[model samples]
Target: MKRKLVIGDIHGGFKALIQVLDRAKVSVDDQLIFLGDYVDGWSQSSDIIQFLIELSEKQNCIFIKGNHDAWCEDWLSLGGTPSVWLSNGGQKTIESYDNYSDEELERHLEFFQRMKNYYVDDQNRLFIHAGYSSMHGPEKEVYSSNYRWDRTLWETAVSMDKKLSKNSELYPKRLLLFKEIFIGHTPTIELGSKEPLNKANIWNLDTGAAYTGALSIMDIDTKEFWQSDPLPALYPDENGRNVW
Candidate 1:
């Protein structure tokens, strides 16, 4: 069977993205599910999106939206970029397109606009950039914009035992609807873990590629994973996460 490979946030660390993919040995047969945050932070945000655009053409790919991606899309489609977004690394995304054509930039914005907030496969595996309310499936109109912005879903899962209760009703409410859930945005490094974390059947794949940890990718079925080196190390003399 073709493998299901889920990737964490890229955060504009294009070199780190390449490293993780190379380590994962991704092939055309595998389905690559990106957990979003493709831009912002570090630099080369445009380069990363272009690379992904080509990669999607070569392989099965699904791109979910992250909160940072929403900010980028809003600025691109409209005029005023939010001050908070710029302070949180949106400026680098702007800088990355210094040499790009208007058409190319438009394409990037369209990609962002078309991205999904959540993905539920035939297996009922849920992939999202952040959290979900769990009150309904991904189709609910109420969750259209909140799925990628909510953090409570993951927090609820983390609060439960890593080994959840056997009782059907005991699972974290947000995760009960899916066979398993994969998410990014909440970096594992911030949780004091340098590795992908599994709790309440939800996996947090982001290993803080923009900092001292690596970008992570995992096989959903086999649970096998790969990582790139600390992204800061990938770009010596440049402050990777200090785009702030």
Candidate 2:
């Protein structure tokens, strides 16, 4: 049976990414929807992007751009390295690219350029790297960066009163725009959960692979998930975006 798998933030943990995909028995028949942040943490940021480019050729993929990805793209194309980004893992991403040739970097840049801000499927499910503030949905968002940086959507869902029905006037308008929303960027570890979190039809898949938590992947339909070993264990010699 074909599965639609949604992946969380990678943060350059390519080994973990590979482990979970194998553990899940992912195949060409599966549709992989990546909730970005593919770079900026562990040692293989550049390699992860390269692998994704190759993987997309053999399987269906939808890559949603994340804030980290956006920053990386800017550095790659404009040659401006933001200190904030560097402090947050961009430095490691830069180090990871030291061995790549200019031509290869260009290819990787193109890959980043092609990533989507958000994707809405035929079933009305939304796959985005982060949340959007628009009550009308992501398409009508005035500040496009919110698509890759907003946390209010997740915050609203998780903090809503459980007794409130969707039909209630007090219900959040943004939640009504989609059947379901899948996002990455805010790690679930912050909420004290090491697994995928579902609140008010929003699924947060980021389990903090960039720090100490494990990387995760989930079947949107089955809600079944697979996770890699904690990233620190996978790369004990390195600290992956642990500071901020």
TM-score winner among the candidates?
2
Least well predicted 10-residue stretch by lDDT in candidate 1: 235-244
Clash count, one per candidate: 0, 0
Candidate 1 C-alpha lDDT tens digits along 201-231: 7899988876677889999999999998888
> Residue 202 error for model 1, in Å?
0.3
Judging by lDDT against the true structure, name the best candidate. 2
lDDT of each: 0.84, 0.94
How many residue pairs in model 2 have overlapping backbones?
0
Give the range of the ten consecutive residues with the poorest summed lDDT in model 2. 235-244
In terms of lDDT, model 2 sits at 0.94
Q: Indicate the TM-score of model 1.
A: 0.93
